[model samples]
Target: MNDLTLSSLTGRTVLVTGATSGIGYETARLLAERGATVLLHGRTDGEARAAADRMIATAGVNGERLCTYGADFALLDEVHALAARVNANHPRLDVLVNNAGTAAPERHTLTADGNEIAFQVNFLAHYLLTHLLEAALTSDPGGRVVNVSSSMHRTGAIQWNDPQRARRYSRVAAYAQSQLALTVFAADPRVTAVSVHPGVCDTAMLPLYAHEGCAPAEGAAHLVRLCDPATEIVNGAYYDRDQRVEPAPRATDERTVKRLNKLADAAVGVGS
Candidate 1:
């Protein structure tokens, strides 16, 4: 494990999705405090702007250091639009925090994109966003992606032929599958990326983990650390909070990584 020292983020730009609330909000706040130009993404424009306002008010973050973007992860077109706006506005993005996610609803639901709701929001949208922002992301060295995956991914198995789980649906399985896919995505050779389980945070999704959980900021700290350029990262590495740890076996498998890229490219309408 590289002993990561958190350094000033001056002149760096970071985008954190789902920044309207919970861990995402805190992560954005911490990054902004550390001098990064934090882009706060929410499900809607108003929500994103509101998050920025709150940050400015409570965290003492300068309004000048923050920007807001809105995109509903369940909608692939919106994700593309968000990426386009970012690339046009900030050509040299330093970090992308794929933190927007949702718990699988009690019943199976599908997005307008025809994917399982959780799968689309938690994985496919991010996959598309990352690939679309390749120009900005690769504009400089040390630029990387940080996936806020989960430990629950260990229980997940990619339902290769039935990713939607249309025939046999379980909310737990659906959410885990999405997370596993995100973890596997970090291994793609096209970009520098890593995934981490940010611990059981006290947020809307707390029920999925435990009855009680730690503060959202505690979990956000782990994410902020990885976003720092000083934190040496190996592509595809998975961390549990601040400690590097092995992810599920399939997460590191080269064959699985390539296979997943194909599946995601088709799903997101990206060329292989």
Candidate 2:
């Protein structure tokens, strides 16, 4: 094990979603290198398995010790099944990095679940996953949930009357709304959650907005820092890159949090 990773992450188990590419991919590799048992997730079996293989080889861990899981975040059923699988197999999870996201900057689309695709993929799936796996996380003495939000959410607001954006929608609005909701969800008192803006990294999603920013490694570094057990970030706070920042006023509003919780509970059929 690399000395740094070995010291900070050895014996810890971390699950990073969207680990097949971009910041997620780099974050998984870094965690694996540091000696954490990393569960890599993707929307496809082949890509996730391949990522697992690379991590095993790179980290010099036994192939049998590394694992991968798949689920299409666009589908809530798949998200539930994923949570069940992880909860069943890994009873103790020290960290969960909800880094998966989508960008449909041109238009709005709906998932089979009737929720906006970006809303479901970027926010709802992760919200449900974290809720279902709360036990696994809380079982550990020092557990953390890192939600990958974005600075773009600064201008976003959830449409209370049209949460699905069925009346009218744009990719930008949907994406930002989803991100803001996610940051709000992270405020759940049941878990020690930290939401982050991984910076505008050069990734596949960048082209959706025709923007370029930092390297994926640089973006992943911020996530890795938050995941570090020794870091001093306040639970339920938001960060831009590594610096904590105030989210949009709507995100901090008390009513905003409650309304989001109610909607999420209904969307995932949690309390029903």
Candidate 3:
């Protein structure tokens, strides 16, 4: 780990999705503590605004330095709308932390958009958001797209024929697939993307998928480390518990990236 600490974030701007609670909330809170102008996102406007206000009251971070945006990730149209709003207002974003994800334990659920719920919320939504914000990210050569993936992705695979797991559904398979997709997309050379396995933290998701781990603050620290400008992590690399490691073989395959990109483009109504 580098010496670049949260204090180094002074004056930078970061947008964190799912900042309402869990790791996302901790990450956003710490970043704001570091003096970054942070934009918090939640599934609804009230949720996001309330979260930002709470941060101000609890952390003493200036209200002007922190704001909120809302969008339901399970819907493609809402994702697009959120991106447009961000671009229209804040044209310069130094870092993007895609910390939002879902874990549905027992059932196979479909989004209103007709896509698998996990796939849409965890991976596809972030994919669309990243592309839409490419301009702002690339504007500063030091900008980064930090994707919160998981070590479980090592067992993940792209269901090429059934990208949405339409044929059959397994909670484990869907969650793993979504994480793998995020890692694969992070490997794209056009932008500075970093994938992170934030560890199994004790959060609301724990009951849904039980595992022993640290608190949200500890997990958020791993993300903060990656966001540190002085940290010399190679772009498009995967980090497991703050240490860079090779992801699953499929995540590094060129063919896998291409196929997934194509499918994602089609799914989001964007051209390949």
TM-score of every candidate relative to the true structure: 0.97, 0.92, 0.95
lDDT of 1 by residue, 32-112 (tens): 988899989999999999999999998899899999999999999999999999999999899999999999999989999
* Residue 233, model 1: Cα distance from true site in angstroms: 0.5
Residues 1-272, model 2: lDDT tens digits: 12235455778889999999889988988777666788899998788998888767765655654579999999899998999999999989989999999885566678899888888999999989998888899544557999999887886888988998988888888888888898987777667998999888899778644576788988898888788787766677999887898877777677777788899889878971
For this target, which candidate reaches the highest lDDT against the unseen true structure?
Answer: 1
Candidate 3 lDDT score relative to the true structure: 0.85
- Provide the overall lDDT of each model, using Cα atoms, as 2-decimal numbers: 0.93, 0.84, 0.85
Which segments of candidate 2 are over 4 A away from where they belong? 1-6, 57-65, 139-141, 208-210
Model 3 agreement with the true structure over 1-272: per-residue lDDT tens digits = 33435246787889999999989998998888777888899999999999988888887877877879999999889999999999988889999999898994568888988889999999999998998988877445558999999887888887888887888889989988998999998887767888999888998767544667689888898998887676666777999877888888888788887888889988888875
Candidate 3 ranges beyond 4 A from true positions: 1-6, 208-211
Q: Is 2 or 3 the stronger prediction by TM-score?
A: 3
Model 3: how far residue 157 lies from native, Å = 1.6
Better of 1 and 2 by lDDT: 1
Using lDDT, rank the candidates from best to worst: 1, 3, 2
